[model samples]
Target: MRLSRYFLPVLKETPAEAQIVSHRYMLRAGMIKQASAGIYSWLPLGFKVLRKLENIVHEEQVRAGHIPMLMPTLQSADLWRESGRYDGYGEEMLRMQDRHGRDMLFSPTAEEMFTDVFRSHVKSYKDLPLTLYQIQWKFRDEIRPRFGVMRGREFLMKDGYNFDQSKEDALHAYNRHLVSYLRTYERMGLQAIPMRADSGPIGGDYTHEFLVLAETGESEVFYDSEITDLKFGDREIDFDSVEQCQAVLEEFTSRYARTDETHDEAVFNALPEERRRVARGIEVGQIFYFGTQYSEALGATVQTPDGTSVPVHMGSHGIGVSRLLGAIIEASHDDKGIIWPEGVTPFHCGIVNLKQGDEAADGACEALYGSLTALGLEPLYDDRNERAGGKFATMDLIGLPWRITVGPRGLKNGVVELTCRRTGESEELPPEQAVAKVAEIYAGI
Candidate 1:
């Protein structure tokens, strides 16, 4: 993509309403624009990153044996009524009536709708261990929606529901989700700690919220500092093996961690003083093992081997797909701008033509751009006829992982400047070597 042809309307000044770093940067970078008080229109760059995050979630979910499907943004109020939550869900759910006077809603969550789907077609224990998910837009009318996408009125989310024959199977599904979520966040260059959290409206005794610790986070959290040291790394796990999944769940959750809603001072005090820590956290995902809460209410029962019927054990897992953009920026950005991780960056690297019209410089940048693109990588070339300072500033503001600076001076010496956006470090290398290095850096990711 060439900067001259792109539609990035970056701002020279931050919007006064953007209170946090992510929100401010997002506005200044022209990643999103406010459509309403708490709603936004994702610009091209923001949409690209959002899609990248969505794809990662899909890949991890599929790797864990979950099926993907689509669900509507609007749903009938009848399903919520059957689950006895039509009135109980409160104002956050956007309830209304259609032309025929049937009560409908812009779904804040899909527990009731998914249960309705389960009961409609699934009727036997043989097909009990099914997990289905969708990446869709959800609306929750926040009373005071702020913080850009972090607490928006409408957001994108990946919510999955698991149906099982027994409590044990349902719990295993919960663990599988935990493992997959860990991978998903890590791939996006975030360490989202799985903390014991209160399942407010979802109604579950067993739940964990994955949070990325940031000073601007909404949730106050207490934890043992050791929990921050855990990482899933590249270890292999059989998602179908209960023991394997259970082991990972224990490994990651054994430490003391809880959100403010579920915090116990006594339990926290038991930890070593050195390990005790308190901080703020941005919630990026959650998993709930609600058992028969939805199934029983909706009559989503399956016939057992002996011909008896029982409500299927069930759970719902979710990742805040759009909010993750804010969380990643909050956790990864520096004073200058967002430092996108290679795995989720809109472009793999950037090409800066320091002397845009200079023949040698222009030729070098064009060659580098072609080389990177041919290697299955995306490069954003700043080919605009602008000053070197302005071009460099734009590259830094957009925060591509790597940048290749081509200039007549560097080309005369048979080298180009390859710089790391995160480290502020640069290396002088031949044009081909710069491209090769960028490719090598993202190969593993």
Candidate 2:
């Protein structure tokens, strides 16, 4: 996209309301706009990143054998009542009534609604292993919604529900989700530790919250420092094999890790002092194995092979799709601005014409942009008639993973400056070489 035609309303001064790095940078970088006290309108750049995250989630989920479908933002209160949570869900739920005075709600979660769908059509054990998910908007009316998208009242989330015939099957589904989530977060350049965590209103005895450690995180966390050394690198796996999935679950969760809500001082003290670490964590996702909690409550039963009706075993998995933006920024940004990972950057590379109107400089940038675009990559060309410093500052602020600097001086030497945002390193390469390097960097991703 050309900077001159883009609708990025960057701020010269940070908003006073932004209290953290992610919030301040998001505001000053023109990623989001506050539509209300606890709500926001995602600007083009922000929306692009959000969609990228959603796509990664969808791809990983499908690879793990889960199907995707969408659900509504608003649902009937009757479903919540059927699940026995209508009154128990408390003020975070936005309860309302329609024109006919039928009670309704802006759903904070879709447990009850998903269960309703299950009971209505899925009546046999043959469909027991089905897992369905949706990426949609959700609302939870927090009394003090701060930290931009991190703790906003309205957010985007990917929530999946699994239905199974037995406890063992349900547990396997849980493990599958854990494996998929590990891949999902790693693809976004995050290391989300799966820590034993309390299941808050969801009512599950078994649950794990994936957290990215950041000083600005809200949840106080304790962990074995060795856990931080763990990485889910690129590995082949059969998602359908219970043993494989279970092995991964054990590998990632064997370390001592827990949030403040479930911290046990005695257990933590047993770990070697050198291996113990305490810090703050931003929750990016969670998985729950609740057995029959929602199914029994909502009468989502299936017929067994022996002709008996039984409540299906179930679990729910979720990724905070929008909040992930804040978590990624908190974990990856430097003092200057966000350093977006290549996998989720809005633009793959940026083209800066150090001398915008100069014929040679402009021609070089246009050529580089075309070369990158032809390779199925998007490059932001700062074609605006602006000073070199201003253009470079904007490129840094928006945080593209790669940048190509074009100038008459560089062109005369048959070279262009290619810079990496994460490392303040640059290399002088020919225009084609710069484009080829960027393409190869993202090829595996």
For each candidate, give its TM-score against the true structure: 0.99, 0.99
Per-residue lDDT over 322-431 for candidate 1, one digit per residue giving the tens place of the 0 to 100 score: 99999999998888888999999999999998887888988888899889999999999999999999988888888898999989998999999999999999999999
lDDT measured at residue 98 in model 1 versus the true structure, 0 to 100: 92
Give per-candidate clash totals.
0, 0
- lDDT of each model, Cα atoms only? 0.94, 0.94
The parts of candidate 1 lying over 4 Å away from their true place are none
lDDT of 2 at 353: 91
- Which ten contiguous residues of candidate 1 have the minimum total lDDT? 354-363
Candidate 2 wrongly placed segments (more than 4 Å): none
